[model samples]
Target: MVLGRQRRQIMKILIAIDSFKGSLSSKEAGEAIKSGILRVIPDAEVLISPLADGGEGTVETLVEALGGSLETVRVKGPLFQEAEAHYGILSDSQYSPKDEKLAVMEMSQASGITLVSPEERNPLKTGSYGVGEMILDAYHKGCRRFLIGIGGSATNDGGIGMLSALGFRFSKENGEEISPIGEGLKDLAGIENASVPEGLLQCSFQIACDVENPLYGENGASLIYGFQKGGNKELLSQMDLWMKHYSELVKEYNPAANPEAPGSGAAGGLGFAFRSFLQGELKSGVSLILEETKLSKKMQGADLVITGEGRLDEQSAMGKAPIGVAKLAKTQGIPVIAFAGTVTEGAKACNQAGIDAYFPILREITTLEDAMNKETAKQNLADTVEQAIRLYRLQHKKQ
Candidate 1:
């Protein structure tokens, strides 16, 4: 009988891990996995790579994992022009702005809800204006294909902030031009296509999104994720109404349109704004990250690929890093084991998709914070790996 713990190719092993979130960065996660590997097979040639899904720490994760370097830029923040913020961009790798390569950007860098303080959680006036500036910077740097990740945004202004930078205009009554803030949207009567930026129009644009929310109404951005941006019950209805009106305005501008377009509700109707106005393609963030990082190149020669994230469950199979890795590895005839912070109930179903095994590290943990401590998390992870590998050996040891 062949032991399940049989080496992938008699010796070499490659493991890839993503951040445990609030505890480990993807680098830390990879190191912890390596520590676990050392206990079982001391000589396993582990190839560790960090990963991010274009969320909070996407820039740093990509930079470190793919030998991409960091470039710092000062930009506008979500609110208060006096608010100066910094965003990290790829430097050494392919997305370098110096060489006019396409620069990847995630909405969280400029307009993420997490940046806002409790006092600053006013979504009514919050705008994606900073995101617009980032895109403009990329355009000026000669970046043609903008891979924009639309997630964790503070503003529900749709893509108006970005459109403004691209030379699109919203208008109020009496033909007065206006911005696209939610409150301002209430005053929006028409869209004036006069001011599209020459540079932006010449370039290509795409959205990295995992959501499928439509552009307007109940299934739209405002109704779905708006409350997280601090939308009260009243603003919820108001925001939806505003998006509905903008939807009509968008369709009037284009006959082949519906605010109800798939993924239209992403980024507070930013998806619709991008689709209708910027003519951007909406894609899954996981696929885009995988393509850019060229993970396949690293995974090519690996024996076994161990992938992980902060948690593993039904959602992991959707568009998360572990699921993406598992699917690709399975296709390549590689066995994939998933290690995670915690696995929800019914985690066995995780195997039906692509994962060969799932392990959760939360033992005797009461609160999430308790599980998130760095040393604790690392130890728990090591223990989980040790037990799992031992179990694999026990189950398949030849008689």
Candidate 2:
């Protein structure tokens, strides 16, 4: 019925778009969209809520959404070196109680592949010890609810390093404690859980994940994602076997651990560690972000919602932010449109995924390198959005 209303009566528009990755930040992208909407209807009430799917921009997006600040902490890096990592804490929010602080973290900050040099990117050498430290840092600051994005990793340690940081020690058959890493898993004779941080069990974690790879196998972490982290074919085979051994050992410590579940292979097996050890729940990243940001409430009485990402493709339907936003708006009977830096081959699928229509930001054929230039991306995004809105208004002209 809302869609049936006249264009003059539909004043509010919601813009919940993710970052353009290399070109624009979430806030910047949202601003571009807002500018576009304002160009068509200068007095329109456009609400811009920048978003991310628990990935690199998660902290900034959530902090901006919930009115919080980023807190920096010193933590161990993937290579056992000192590293600085940041997490966002929602000190206050319109939705959350003042007493409760929600933390959003991205594991890639401290243990991402980009942090390591290409030559030193061996999965066997890197670890996720820093990720656990980030959690502890947030926990010490009184954050009990964690929204974690577990994408972009530099290790295949099966999360041994993270578990070690949280008080689970890996010992060899000789009772000697060993440093946790992918190769070190071969010596994982036993695990000591007595030293795990106290009150850790009281915390709850919601992992933002999109993949469904299991812990170890052809489709698992090592086989699928390890090569990008410097694992050769031979190293991948070895790491896979070690991961199997590590999972078996972990099962001995926690009988309920299920490493084969969907998303268990994410971030070099950090998904398994969180699910099996920390008792975390894995969910679609954009969905979690939507709930945290109270998108539905913000969208109330809106005539249209616009969302976008760096690209639109078949993968957009696989838990991408735009499609997620579209699906939410669909439930409210609101029409949704998306704009992307480039509309790829499979982008037509978005129509079936709840998006009423979509458009590409680029106005002319150009190299990806050229299209991603910050100024170019911004102008293209704004121009495309303006034209799209003009077309939308034309379609709804007095019948």
Maximum-TM-score candidate: 2
Residue-pair clashes, model 2: 0
Residues 1-399, model 2: lDDT tens digits: 665666557578899888898898888888988898899989788998868887778898777756788999988888988899988998664645556778889998888888898988888888999988888888888888888999989988988888888888899999998778778888889988799777887787899998899999999999999999998998899889988988998899899998899999999999999999889999988888998888999988898899989999999877688888998998899999988888888998999999888888888989989999998998989999999999888886753
Best by lDDT: 2
Measured on C-alpha atoms, candidate 2 has an lDDT of 0.87
Runs in model 1 lying further than 4 Å from the true structure: 1-12, 38-45, 71-74, 91-100, 117-120, 189-195, 230-235, 252-257, 361-399
lDDT on C-alpha atoms for all candidate structures: 0.74, 0.87
lDDT digits (tens) for residues 1-399 of candidate 1: 366556453555567677887898888788888888778877767787667776667766775665643544556666635344333445443544345456667777777787788776776877887777777776676567677788888888877776776677888888887755666788887777677676676666767888889876778788788788888878788878887887788788876666776788888878888888777888877777777666777788666788888887777766677777778787778778889898888667779878888888887947877789898898888888878866654564542
> Candidate 2: misplaced stretches above 4 Å?
1-10, 95-98, 363-380, 397-399
Worst 10 residues of 2 by lDDT: 91-100
